[model samples]
Target chain A: MNTKPKILIVDDKPENLKALRKVLKDLDIELVEATSGNDALKATLCHDFVLALLDIQMPGMDGYELAGILREEEKTAHLPFIFISAVYTDNLNVFKGYENGAFSFITKPFQPEILINKVKFFIDKHQQEVALYELNEELKNANKELDAFTYSVSHDLRAPLRAVNGYAEMLNEDYGTHLDDEGKRLIENINYYAKKMGALIDDLLAFSRLGRKEIQVSEIDMNEMVEGVLIEMNKSITHNAKIKIGKLHQVNADYGLLHQVMFNLISNAIKYSSKKEHPIIEISSNEKNGKIVFSIKDNGAGFNMKYADKLFGVFQRLHSQEEFEGTGVGLAIVQRVISKHKGNVWAEGNINEGATFNFSLT
Target chain B: MDYEVEILIVEDNMSDAEMTIRALKKNNLTNKLLHLKDGAEALDFIFARENYSDRKIENIPKVILLDLKMPKVNGIQVLQELKSDERTKKIPVVILTSSKEDPDIQECYCLGANSYVVKPVQFEMFVKVVSELGLYWMILNQPPK
Candidate 1:
C-alpha cells in the first residue's frame, strides 16, 4: 500500500526537477515527474496528486497556460498549483499566475524552506478532506445498518408475541370453565403483557421506518386534517374534554406524516387532561415569522419543566405507566416526522399545570 | 389427498398454520382446507410435481393463503409461479404475513395477488381477520368453473 502523498512536478529541465525533488525529499511523498504540460495531464489521470509544481519557462506551454488547462478539466480543477518562474517575475505576472488558479508563486532564486512550507500546507489540507469524506461515508453506512437491524428485529419479535397471545387465548377458550378465578386472571395478565409488547414492537418499527421514508410534500388544510383526526380519535377514545379548535392556516407538508404528528399531539392532550374537572383542549395554528406554527394546549396533568428535554426521546417517559398508558414512542415519532419536514417541535408546561405543544414548519 | 381442497395454506410456522386452521374452522371453512409446511411443498402440490406427482394438477384450490417469509422459496416466488402459469393463475392467492415493512406487498400485488393481509398480533383480531377472509373467499367469492 502506497500511503505516501503524491506530488506532480512539471518542469522541462531535468536539473530543475531534481532541485525541486531534493527540497521535498525530506517530506514523505512520491514525486511524479512530467516534462511537459500534456505529460502532467496524463499523470493526473493515473495518480491523485495532492499538489502540483509548474515551471513557467516551458517550451510549448507555460506554467500559467497549464494551470488554466488543468482548471478547465473537472478531474484536476481543484488541484492546487505552485508556479515556479524565472522570466515572469513581475507583479502583473504573479497576478496572472493567480488568475489561472495558482495557489503560490516562487521566483527561480527562492528559498527551499518557503516552497516546502507551502507544499506541506496543501498536503495536510488534502489529507484532512480525505479523512472527513471517509468518515461521512462510514457514518451513512452505519445509519443504514441500524435501520435494517431495528426493522428486522422488531419484525421477528411479533411472531413469538403472537404465539404467546394466541396460546393464552386458546387456554382461556378451551379451559375457562375448569380453571379457578386466579388461573383465569393469570391468563389475562399474560395476554395483556403480550399485547403490550406487541404494541411496543409496532411503535419501534414505525419509528425506525421514519428514518428511511422519503418525505412527499403536499398542501394540507389544517382545519380539515384536524377534523379527520378528531373523528378518528373519537372512535378509539372516550373522553369528556371540551375541545375547541381555532381557525388554522394551510401548510405544505407530507399528509400522512403530518397526520401522525397531529394525532399523537391531540391524543396526548386528551389522555393527559382526562383527569381535569372541566378538561379543555384548545387547538390553533398561525403564521409566525415566515413559518406556520401550530399549538395544542390541554388543561390536564402536565409535566415539570425540568425534564422537558427528555420528553421527545424514544421510550423516554416522564410519567410512570400507571399514571399514563404510553409506550413513550409517540412523541419521538412526532419529533422525527416534524424534523424530516425541516420543522421544529417544542412544549411549555409545569407540574400539575396546563401544557402547550407547538411545532413550526418553514 | 383425494378430497377436493378449497383453501391451501402455505406457511412454514406450525403455530401460525394451526391458528389459521382454527380460525377457518370457526367459520366452517376448514372441511376442504389443506395446510403445507413450506414453499417447496406448496409449489410441488400446486404444480403436481415431485412428491405430489400422484395428485392431479386439475384439483386447484379455491384460495391460497400464502405467507411472505418462508424457507425454500418465499411467497413472491410462489406468487410469481402461480400467476404466470395459466392453469393455476385463476386460483385466488391471499398473502398473510407478520410484517408490512417490506416492499413485498407492492411486488405481491404486481404479481397478481388476489389480496394482501397483514396478520394481527392480537389473537382476537387475528381470528376475526382470518375467519372473515375464509368466509369472503370461500362463500362469497365465486371461482371460475
Candidate 2:
C-alpha cells in the first residue's frame, strides 16, 4: 500500500497549527508543521507535499506572499495551496489569493468536514498526475530500447552470420575437387541453411523498419498496384497458374506498404496453389461498412481453419518446410502494415480446399 | 606496378578484410589493391602523413571501401576528414558496412560518401557484391585530373 499523502500546515501561532493538526489527525495524512512563511519555504525544500495550508496573517511574509514565491520556482510552481485567515476575508484579499495560485481558501474556525473534503480532492488529483507522468516516462524508455535492439540486429548479428556463410562458401569452392560426394553434400547443406538464415534476418529487419518508418499516406489504385506487383514478382508465379483480378477500388493508404501487402498475398496465393496442374488464384475487392475489404483466393494446399488464427503471426506457418519454403514473416508484415493504416487482416480456409486472405482499410 | 594504389579497403575485422580482398582477387583486381586494418591507417595513407610521408598524396587511390565501425576513428569521421580536406576530397569513398541502420546511411551520405552498400550475409552474395563493386570503381569510374 502507498504511504499517506503529505500535507504542509503553516501558521505563526502554536494554537492555530495545533487546531489544524487536530482536525486533520483523523484523516490518513502525514502533516508537517511550520510557524512562519520562511519556515514553510524551508520545509518545502526538504519534502514534497500534496496539499499546503497557510494562514494569511503571519509575520513578515504572509500566506499570499509565500504562494507568490512558490509560483516563481519550477519545483513548487504547481503546488496546491489553501489560504486560511480570519481578518482577510474581503473580496480583494480573496482575489489576491487566487492570483497567487491558491487552490482554495478556508476562513478561521472553518468547518472540519468542509476542510477534509477539499484536502482529499487535491491529494487524489496530485497522486493521479504523478502516476500518469511515470507511465509516460516508461513508454519513452521502451521505444528507445527497441531502437537500440533493432540496430544491433541489423549490424552485430548479421556480421557473424556473414562470416559463417562466407567461409562455408569458400571451403566449398576451394576443396570441392578433393572432397567425396558425401562431403560435398554436407557442405552444400551448410550453405543452404546459412542462406535461409540470411533471408530470415532480412525479413525480420524489414518488419522492424515498418514499426519505425513514418507512413506516407496517399490515394492508391488497387488494380494498378496489383498489376505492378505481379510484373515485379513474375518469376514467383508459375507458368501454369491462372490469375484473375476482379474490380478493385482505390484506397487512401501508404503506397509502399500497400504494395508489400499485395506482393506477399499474391505470392502466397501462387506458391500454395502451385502443386495443382492448373492453379487458380483470384483477387477481388468489395465495399462494406464504408470500408474496402480486399480478398485473395487460391485453389492450392489450403490450411485447416483450426489454425487460421495463427496465420498472421510472425514465423507462424501451417505448412512444413518440405511442402512450402517460407520464412513465415510475410503474413506478419502484412498484418502489421495493414494495422498501421487502421485496418484488419484475417484468413479463412479448409484442408486441401483453398484459402482466402482478407484485409480491410478503415 | 608504378607503386599506384587502385583500391584502398579500410576494414577492422580480419575475416572481412581477407574475404573482401579475396573477392577482388577473384575478379582479377589483385595488383593495386591495398588493405588497411583500420580507419586511422587509411587516413594516414591518403594524406601521406606521419609514417606515410614517403608516399605521394597526389597518387591517391581511385576508390576507398571504408567500413563504418572501427577503432581509432570511425568511418563517418574518416569520411568527414577526407571530404573536408581539399587534397583528398576527390577520391571516391564507398561505405561498406554490415549496418543498414537509417541514421548511419543518412550520416554517411551527409559526410560525402560516394556510395553505400550493406555487407550481404550470404558468402556468395558478398563475393558477387564485392567483385561487382570492385570492377565498377576500379575500371568504370573516372577521377578528376
Candidate 3:
C-alpha cells in the first residue's frame, strides 16, 4: 500500500509552494508546504515526507537547524534534504549546505526542471531506504513472534501434556487389574500417544528457537564431542552394537549446534539398528579442504537412497509410525542446527546393507 | 464470608468433570466438593449473595480450580475479578487448560492466578493429576482461615 512520494516545501511564501506543487503536479507526488522553519519542524513530526525542500534564508530556526533536528531523530534520520533558497549567496553558503547534510542546493530563480529533477532524485533514494528499513523491522517482529511461541510451548504447553501423562499413569496404577485387557491396552496407548505428542511439541519448539539463537563460532573438538555423544548413546543402546571411530580432527563451529548434529546422527544409527544381528556402527571425522567433514555409518535396515533428500524435511519420516517410533523431527533438527551454523547435512543409504550420514561446516 | 469447601472445580466438560470427581473420590476428598459447569455459573456462585439477599454467599472456596477456555465469562476474566476483589483476593486459583499458549499462562498469572496446570490428552494421566491434586491441595496444603 505504498502511495505517491512526498516532497515538503518549507518557505514563508505561499506562491512558491503552490508554484512548486504545480510544476511537479504531473508526477506521482505529494507536496506539503510549511510557511516557516518552526512550522516545517512541526509538520515533519507527523507526516512522512521523502524529500524536504528547505528555504535556507527564512525566519528563526531556519533550514540548517531543521535538518539537524531531523538527523537527530532515529525515526527521520535518513530523510533526504535539499536546500531551496532564493538568495544570491556565495560559494560559502553552498559549502555550508553540504556540511548540514544537504543533498543538493538549488539557487534562487532556479529553473523549474532543475528543482523538479533534484527533488525527485532525493525522493526516490529516500523511498528505497525507507522500504528497506520497513522490511528489516518486519523480519525482526516475525522473529520475536516465533520466539514467544516457542517459549509458550516450552513452559505453558507442558502443563496439559504433563497432566495427560500423569493422569494416564495414575489410571493404570490405581485400577490396573480391575480393568479389562482392552481397557488396559487403551490406557497404555493413550499414554504412549500423549508422550509422543509432547515430544513433537518439544522438537518443534527447539526448531523454532534455533532461528533466533546466536551461534558462537570456535574450534570444537570432534573427538571429545563423538565420545560425549557415545556416552549419551550408551544409556539407550540395548542391542549388541559396535561403534568404530576413525581419526577425528578439530573444526570451527558453534559447539552447541554441532553437538546437536552428532547427537541426532548417532541416535538415528542406534534407532534403525534394532533388527540387525550385531549392529555395526562407525563414526569418522576428517578435514576435507579447509572445512571439517564428519560421517556416521550404520549396518542397519536402510532407506531408499532416492528418497534420502526428503529425510531432512520437517516431520518427514522414512518409515511408518507403527514400524519405527519417532517424532519424525530428528533429522530435520539435525539439518536445521547444521544449517544455522553455516553447514550442510545429507545421507546415502540402501535398504538392508547400511547408510552413511555426513556433514561439513563451512 | 467463610467457605467450607476444599475443592471447587470449574469445568464445562461433563466427562472430564466426572473423571476428575472419580479421581477425587478415590482419594476420599469428594465430600466437600462443589462443581460448576461454566464460568458464568461459577461467577454466580462466587457472587451469589447479590442475587439472593436471604441466601448468604460463603467467604470463598479454600482453593479454586479454574479452566481457562470456558463459555460466557472466561477463566482469565474470572481470575481478574477474583484477584481484584478484596474478599476473594486471598483464594488461590489454579488455571487448568488444554491450551499451552504462553499468552494464556501469562495472562492468567498476570491476573493473579496462584498456579497454572495444562490438561493431559491421555485420560489415565489426567486421572493421576486429579489424584495428586486431591492429595496435594486437600491433605498437604493448609487452607487460609
Best by TM-score: 1
- DockQ for all candidate structures vs. native: 0.86, 0.69, 0.16
TM-score of chain B of each: 0.96, 0.96, 0.89
lDDT of each: 0.92, 0.89, 0.80
TM-score of every prediction relative to native: 0.86, 0.74, 0.64
lDDT of 2 by residue, B1-145 (tens): 2448989999998888889999999989979888888888888888987778789999989999999999889888899999999999989999999887888999999989999998888787789999999999988888778
User: Which is better, 2 or 3, measured by TM-score?
Assistant: 2
**TM-score of chain A for candidate 3?**
0.63
Query: What are the RMSD figures for all models against the true structure?
Result: 3.6, 6.5, 6.9
Ranking the candidates on lDDT from highest down gives 1, 2, 3
Residue A347 Cα positional deviation in candidate 2, in Å, after optimal superposition: 2.1
lDDT by residue (tens digit), candidate 3, B26-84: 88988888888888777777776443334345556677888887779888888887789
lDDT score, residue A293, model 3?
77
Best by lDDT: 1
Interface RMSD of 1: 0.6
What tens digits encode model 2's per-residue C-alpha lDDT throughout A181-288?
Answer: 999888889888878888888898898788787899999988999999999988555456799999899999999999999999999998999898889999999999
